[model samples]
Target: MKGRSVILGQINGLEAAALMVDGQLEDLLIDSSGFAPLPPGAICRAKLGRQMKGQGGVFVDLPEGQTGFLREGKGLRPGDTVICQVAGGAEPGKALPVSLRVLFKSRYAIVTPGAPGLNISRRIRDEETRDGLQALADMVMEGSDMGLILRSACEGTEDGEIVEDIAAMRDLAEAVMADLDGAPELLVDAPTPHEEAWREWAEPAPDEVIEGDFATHGVLDAIEALASPRVDLPGSGYMMIEPTRALVAVDVNTGNDTSPAAALKANIIAARELPRQLRLRGLGGQITIDFAPMPKRDRQALEQQLRAAIKGETETSLAGWTPLGNFEMQRKRDRVARAMLIGGTE
Candidate 1:
């Protein structure tokens, strides 16, 4: 498949990544200049500053005003600032590339392995009310600065892990506090890509897995260890997946087939593969798949064949094709698809 390529880097304290799909500039990933110099576990405040137009709270601005989202809540007024951390660099023109948190410190860290919407945060508040509980609740209710969010690494983690993470954050916070006037650096560790994927898949099970051509054996081995069967596709047809401002498109073609029926068969095979692709690739929102046209007699048979192939593959519901020969469907968007595809574990 032919597509552009780009480099991801931190440019002037902002999270910036360049894209060149198909050898063309597809997009550029950029976060706030205020969010420059991102460090793992470092929490920064995002405010609706005077230069910005939207109401204050947590504002995730996108290029060309596409895929931008604003979240407002108590303690997040037009002028009030909310705490956020650079979860990681997001793809260009994507919404909320950076993850935001209401509280800095949490008690229990929630982790979702390999699942897109998987979130990791510390739980600060407890329902059970007692002397210490009341104090902790008050701190959470008041939004104290001492709290820090524990990431997905804390899932099924022993108390020792939580304590160690908290201690690390405390020490880092102390250093920042001590050097109030100087540039401070805090080192926060993020989970490995494999660990993150494990967490997501652990959340919602996958029936089978298809490994990418470029994926490393170690990566595949790690995923396979999680109990999902893996299969490598035959090197015949090729696919190009592009995520645009409007929707995501998957184009398929018989790159090497010579038979007349080969294209139709390949199209049918590709269509059948869509559901699994959507799950494994996490392709959400409106998705369009353009494949080589099939013969009129084969159309319905191909549709049924694809449907049967993808039955019960994911949470997404697939509809039959329209009269125009277009198959339409929607996938849930709990988290960003690029995060999953590009291999990020948070």
Candidate 2:
């Protein structure tokens, strides 16, 4: 997936859940497990784990089992669960850390490293600019217990947008601070939904497109307009793509073929369809494609043809078939393959 998708819930406070495209839950960096209460600024050792439904790693008091989550994109190992002490408590469930003495311990600072063309520090200063920057710093330094990175929105952003974000953070901070003693001790800021972000950032402009029977017409029309001059596959042959933490598999079948050379023809046709399928489905990362088998000679020719077909595509690497007759390939994980396959509808 290109970005994070959020799930909303309430447990004393608002909680946002984020999952990968294939549904592997990420870590949410706030403490949720009830345990010994640590006052704000009290240093205490804790343990942390990456939750499957949020965007960051969660922290917990090691021996107590009370959990806390860290920010997304923080490199966390599945096995390197750590021991951390609370440096301070902010917004109830949120805590700050003092030292990195524990394994897999993430820092409590939010820093957005800048890129060559994307300068994050560059901003438009105005009356609201000063107030917004100060408010953002205050929220990061006080409200959230973990580090915060100013999103790309900070790049080339106007004072008004900055002020708006600052205002949102301020409101969230106020709510969190106010509910520290109430039934909602932990307050969660609503997470921005993926669909809204995708609509704003990655909506494509295509010339012509095709939609499957399962797809909505409005979505299909939008995709068709973006992928103009494209054609859809005919007949009953279908492909199923499944992505897992281990690997991605693409299965191609000859749904309605009735020819004597059905196997060979299906293999060839599937091979021909492979390139388009990969592109249309946005299949990436480590990929394995299995097609109905053909004769040895035809298999060799088909492999060569398929390889040639996808030679110029970006960020795609292909390898010849193995003795077991499956094609092995690699694609960079960036976009959602499922969305592409469904023509960006689902």
Candidate 3:
């Protein structure tokens, strides 16, 4: 309850994994209950469809009459079959976003077909470790045409484990790339929430790993708090995260604070907390934040705070302040919403 804990459980028959740090929910991943036409990270073979003309993308013919939209459609024509990976989660009744640049990713390595290179993650600054990893990559990828990227997780990992991980992924990529006879078929399925938690959250091992039910670890309560409209911030402040049809609107407020700097304090707190809030809630796309009333001079400082908070979030992009004095951002949809994951639908 007071340290980093990884809780795995089931919600409405779907799988879920939650990460709690110092009793606060840091991250959450809930299974999509197979509702997603193409879950994130899914690789498939699809028949290319004609361009939409106005959308700057073409439709892909997925299995079971499902269609995916690929934004990069250069040199592709109707009836041509190409391999693609699910770019992100799909919107309700919309085409699943797919990318022509397929990548095979794992905890320790990423195998990129059609690309050729061997590199190490920049996070691992130890030159000795990088050289050893590069040697291992060369050994395993000697004859391979695809690119091999050793992830940062390889920093302290054992050589045997890293070798095996790279080999397995290399084999998978080779096998999948050769499967050209399929008719709009799924080649690889996405990892389950619990499995992905293990794959991604192993860098800084959690203090505890609770497997089984959620009630024992108070995960249910944390999830319930996320389902609420208001998130209590520091200094008795709070913010309401409301997802409307067009965009997610967050309204911050300073509660019962008459101090002169109350607005700036609350606004800074909101900037620091909004990333995790939006991430855990699985809210994406357009986001508009109306912070507590503060001086225009403080906006730059608050934006700096917000940028620092979301710098590591690859799917989030800070769009800067709008003319209406609201901060706007664009986040790529990477997972199904909490509503759909917990309740199957809104």
Candidate 4:
């Protein structure tokens, strides 16, 4: 109960994975069926479709009459075949988001086919360690044309595993790249929930791993709670998260607290916990936060806390305070909304 644990289990008949740290649910990933035909990270051989006028983008043919939108179509004409990776799920009836850049990502290494270079994560800054990793990369990637990047998770991973990971990804990349004449089909299927957990949660390795029986560990109940919008905060504060057609709205409130610093305290709590809430719920897009009434001078403090909260996030951008005293930010659509998992929303 005091260390990190990964639960690969089924919740309400759906495959799900949860990362629990110190008995608290830190992260969750669920394989949502009907989210899309090709889930994120799926690779396919697709033929370019008609281009969107004034949009600077084109659609690609997917299996079963499905199509994907690719934003980087310059110099490429319709009917041209190109290998693409599924970027993320589409919004309802829209085309699936896709990208021309394909990457074979594992826990230790990410094999890059387009970019050619051997790079180490900046987190590994020690000169001696960096030198050792460089040598390792050179040895493992001998005669390889594709690029290789050692992830931060590689810092404490075993050398043999690191080597195997790099080699495996490189081999997979080679195989994927070699097939060029196939009909539009899936080359690589998206990773499963448990597989994704292993690939992502390998570093800082969990203290324990539990397989199945998610209900035994309260994961099922947690999922139901996550589907709700009212998240209770410290000092009797709470925030309601609602997703709409255009954006996510966060409204903070200090519940029955008479303290003079109630407004600021509620806002501070909201700022710190917002990212975690969004992450567990898989809610992303344009987000606007309406903090409880506070002084204009408090904006700087709230912004500071918010920036610190998102420092570790890669796909979110802090767009700063709005003219109407609201705060806004943008995030990538990485996964299906948690509410959809429980059939709370369409």
Q: Which candidate achieves the best TM-score against the true structure?
A: 3
Give a tens-digit lDDT track for model 4, residues 90-151: 56777887888898999889999988999998988888888888999999999988999998
Q: Using TM-score as the measure, what is the rank order of every candidate, best first?
A: 3, 4, 1, 2
- Candidate 4 residue pairs in clash (backbone atoms < 3 Å): none
Model 2 CA deviation exceeding 4 Å by range: 1-218, 221-233, 336-346
Candidate 3 structure quality by residue, lDDT tens digits, 8-127: 988778888999899888899888747885688888989999899989999999875789999898888888888888877766788888887788888899999988999998989998
Clashes of 4: 0
Candidate 1 lDDT, tens digit per residue, 112-168?
111223122333233332233333323332432344434434444565555554554
How many clashing residue pairs are found in candidate 2? 33
**Comparing candidate 1 with candidate 4, which one achieves the higher lDDT?**
4
Q: Give the CA lDDT, 0 to 100, for residue 9 in model 4.
A: 82
lDDT score, candidate 3, position 17: 94
Q: Model 1 residue 11 lDDT?
A: 31
- TM accuracy, model 4: 0.93
- Give the Cα-based TM-score of candidate 1 against the true structure: 0.39
Q: How far off is residue 228 in model 2, in Å?
A: 22
- Cα-based RMSD of candidate 4: 2.3
Return the TM-score for each candidate structure. Answer: 0.39, 0.35, 0.94, 0.93
* lDDT (0 to 1) per candidate: 0.43, 0.41, 0.86, 0.86
What does the lDDT read for residue 127 in candidate 3? 88
RMSD of 3: 2.0
